[model samples]
Target: MSDEACRLDVWLHRARFMRTRALAAAFVEAGRVRVTRGGVQQRVDRPGRTVRIGDELVSPSAAA
Candidate 1:
């Protein structure tokens, strides 16, 4: 990975998505998080999705 490449898990955790790395990985495995760029969606499997600043990230909506 390059220095500019930020892992999805790391970004999620840093951005305060999940409490831990394991949780972030779990969310990805469950197909809850969607990483999108250029108007296309990509499912993230690991922490190596290479996220950049201001990238769109969509997760499953919370239950009411």
Candidate 2:
């Protein structure tokens, strides 16, 4: 991952998708988060997954 990349959980938390980083991590581990990069979309099942600035993320909780 590049230096500009951010962890999935951290990004979610920072973006206010989840109230806490732990919650974000759990959401990701449960495969509730989908990430799209380079036009390819895939479920992110790990909190450690790297997310770049242009990456798109989709999660049910985020819509709430």
What do the candidate models score in CA lDDT, each in turn?
A: 0.77, 0.89
Q: Could you estimate the TM-score for every candidate?
A: 0.75, 0.84
lDDT of 2 by residue, 1-64 (tens): 6788999999889988789999989989989989999999999899999999899987774446
Top lDDT hit: 2
lDDT of 1: 0.77
Off by over 4 Å in 2: 1-3, 61-64
Clash count of each predicted structure: 0, 0
Instruction: Please give the distance, in angstroms, between residue 40's alpha carbon in candidate 1 and its true position after superposition.
Output: 1.0
The residue-by-residue lDDT of candidate 1 on 1-64, one tens digit each, is 6666688887788778789988877777777778888889887766567887667888777451
